[model samples]
Target: MTETAAEATGTAAPGTTAEPRTTAELAPGVVIPLIGLGTWPMAGGEATGAVARAIANGYRHIDTAENYNNEEAVGEGIRRSGIDRGDLFLTTKFNRQWHGRTAVREAFGAATRRLGTEYLDLFLIHWPNPSQGRFVEAAEGLTRLAEEGLIRCWGVSNFKPAHLRELQAAGLEVPVNQVQIDPETQQPDQLAFHRGHGIVTAAYSPLGRNGSFLSAPVVTGPGAEYDRTPAQVVLRWQVQSGRVAIPKSADDRRQRENLDVFGFALTEAEMAGIDALDTGAPPRLDSDEFGH
Candidate 1:
């Protein structure tokens, strides 16, 4: 939760530029790093600086959304870092309010314009719209974007296993599915299904919003002998599972930590203990769409 938390993990800030290492290929053309930088609750100038610093310090993947209201800053950060648009993989989500055939195309266009990118690395349906029940319509817009070469890949956020089935049935391949996954609530069922069809899991709030992991004894407790925080452990779990974890931070140090998952490994025993904590924390972000 604090900016200083990441620095404690043994990574420092932008003294030199850092390059990204590819982990799992979300799709044939989309590769998401094991660790990605997240910019939510990182607003305005802070979000802007975080993006730039993340890139300068070696972060290649950034996760953002229209709901975050900071794409322009994210764009500025990309511009300032001078990292090639191709080398950096960026992701953003559409607002749930804009999820219909009537609005999907324009909303997608608006998001691209705001991010200042001609083609997005990935675009997600931010949340499910139950009332509309028009995932197919929205998927059509996404397919159009992909066909037009405006976005390389497309997916959804906060979708459950059943919802994933529905989207797949809609005839759109959901490449990257973003959700709030962490040590306390690792979505094995959801992740298994996603992997079964080659869909990538992009985790949001991977730190449990600093709520679940920090509360767990394994992370913030006497078990700290491993010299890693609950957040880092959860992040490590995400990486070990072949899921893309995006940890957010506005502070220089945490941003570095979010990007610093490459140098360590967790034992299978430790991973099992963490996996035991999965309690399926009651649809914190995307239940409405699941009903559709």
Candidate 2:
């Protein structure tokens, strides 16, 4: 019932050539696949089965978080997938409630136990929790985890450029900045800042939350030209534009379809069309006043 990356490659859909998944090296020896399976709304058996299916479909990068409340299911899916842990990149985050040094250590241990992994490929601070004003202390905990080999690398999520600057001022090295980004909420400035500082931009909601963006002419128009679905077009735009997209789907067919994106390339014009679709609308959650 499970498939290896090689097996998945051999089963590429008709007319589509199988190319190796694209990746970005966040650090000297850390390379993360550009496309990953997001485990947010997925929970319980559904999350477990979806993760297993995603692995079978050739997704090596899996993203989950403490707040997702599905780490156990994500772990079960990995076990069922029958893939070597080393071949997969597993990521999880520390919850906002666990912000201080002691809490981060305890939380990281709990996540490892729940996920059944000896070491995490990457770990993240779920939010800046700027109100708490203890992110510096939390980053220190992540630093300790990295040094002890509990986590390979550590970063932050929902972090604005200002928050990142504050962390940097305190001498913390952030390798990735996960944020909600879609054609509707382009985030060009944030992306630019992350790039300038060598932080990988991991897009959480690469496909607009409501799927409203899919109906846009820019997205559907390219889907028609490339004979691809709107979802595929949007995902391709993310990968092509150089951000890691973690789109969630529980359907097995959709899982396979999502990973099949590497076979095609989007033209510069097509990319521009998607870029022009940004409405600059407000994001779903404003980190400035959000989080635990």
TM-score, structure 2 vs. true: 0.91
The candidate scoring highest on TM-score is 2
- Candidate 2's error at 122, in angstroms? 0.8
Alpha-carbon local distance difference test for all models: 0.72, 0.84
Instruction: Compute each candidate's TM-score over C-alphas.
Output: 0.84, 0.91
1-292: candidate 2 lDDT, tens digit per residue: 1211212222134324456457767665777888899999999999999999999999999999999999999999999999999999999998777888878889888999999999999999988889889888898998898889888888889999999999999988688889999998988789889767777788898887788879988888878877889999998888777688899999988888887787776776777999998888767888878985
lDDT score for residue 54 of model 2: 95
> Candidate 1: how large is its RMSD?
7.0
How far off is residue 86 in model 2, in Å? 0.9
Angstrom error of the Cα, residue 272, model 2: value is: 0.9
Show the colliding residue pairs in model 2: none
